[model samples]
Target: MPTKPTREQWLRHVLSSATLTDAIKVTATELFLEMRANLHVSVPRALLARRLGRSERQVSRRIQVLKESGFLDVIETGWKGRTAVYVGMFKSRGSDAQRVTVSSTLCEAPKRHPLEKPVPVVAGHRVTPWASRHITIGHLRHGVCRNVSTDADASMLEHVPSLDGHAWRSRTAARLTFSARSAWPLLRDTHARLAAHLHLRLRPVAAHHSTAARKRTTP
Candidate 1:
């Protein structure tokens, strides 16, 4: 009798199979990895969702695809609060000739789209286009000031003075300092702007009256 293919061999075959979609192949790979690591073929949908960074519903759909594709067989059905058990099918069914046909089909390379442009290569490495790799100032500004509390704080940090220049430049060091003396004016200006924007009434303080009251009460 022929020797049975090991789990690793089976996984390699499944991954290379052209009949299966990329999503199904990924799900199968995850399941195989789980089985190898844990010595069990039970993987919860929730676990798969977290591992794959997909919704549970999407994971369920992918699992269903694997089941329908004959890569996975349901050993035991899930019950209340219990996950289902599955066993991976590795051995090819039918005669040697039929197996050869299946193998050839699985090993066939996927066809490329006619309209798709070839990726640019530089020194054996693929170079991504500038447009795709570029990060806009708006994105950088948003990322830096995302944690800022107020609109005034956002406005102050939105655009760096150096970055606004005609020539593009990179800074080695950038620092922003705030002392009471410097920050007080900015705070007062912001308060005034906010008050004017909101049409808020400002109550005047009676500093002279308070000073006179303090003098009268003094020892």
Candidate 2:
């Protein structure tokens, strides 16, 4: 049997396959959950798009991401005139027959996720705290989440099958943070100017991550 994925794995897969930037994944998931609730049969892509005001290509792409991430399963295939209809799998199946037959017992309301917290915004819209290795900024529709990484922060990508409008992105964004140790060089070299540039206070961060002294020797 294949090893079951942990919460972390699922989280990463959802983010990656959704082709969603950190800020948009939660919105995407919520949209998906809302759409999944009233399904009798998985309908045509064009219809789904019209309901959400999203382009048909966008819905199709997200579906492909969901499928590759194991969040959605394809059971049978059909046609609405010329549009293809796919049976969606939200859970495990025993046979090909099970895939086509969706069960109400299997479909459940999406859980209320608590991770969608608000972050400070610039002009009342852009997310804030700037950027740092220890913390990441992501948004969903209007919500955002921020977390700290004590050590070096790492980001990796997962391969998801491509869909007509679905996308998973692996591009890394470079950001500098004014609060972290790695930022000492910029902080020290031009403390006054950098502070003004970033609108940061000139005061020091007490304790300053503990590793501040040790890394002085590091490049």
Give the best candidate by lDDT.
1
Tens-digit lDDT track of model 1 for 1-219: 996556787688678665566767788888888775322488888999998899987777777756655667888898769998887765354312222222234446898778567877665424342222223334333333222344433344334443421121222012211325545554445444533532322222245567789999999
Clashing pairs in 2: 19-167, 19-168, 23-139, 23-140, 57-165, 61-165, 61-166, 134-149
Per-residue lDDT tens digits for candidate 2, residues 60-139, read: 66556545434555556545566443333333332223221112212445678786678866663322333332222222
lDDT of 1: 0.56
TM-score, each model? 0.39, 0.24
* Residue pairs in collision within model 1: none
Against the reference, the lDDT scores of all candidates come to: 0.56, 0.41
Give the poorly placed runs of model 2, Cα more than 4 Å off.
Answer: 1-40, 80-219
Candidate 1: misplaced stretches above 4 Å?
36-40, 91-219
lDDT at 137, model 2: 21
Per-residue lDDT value at 160 in model 2: 26
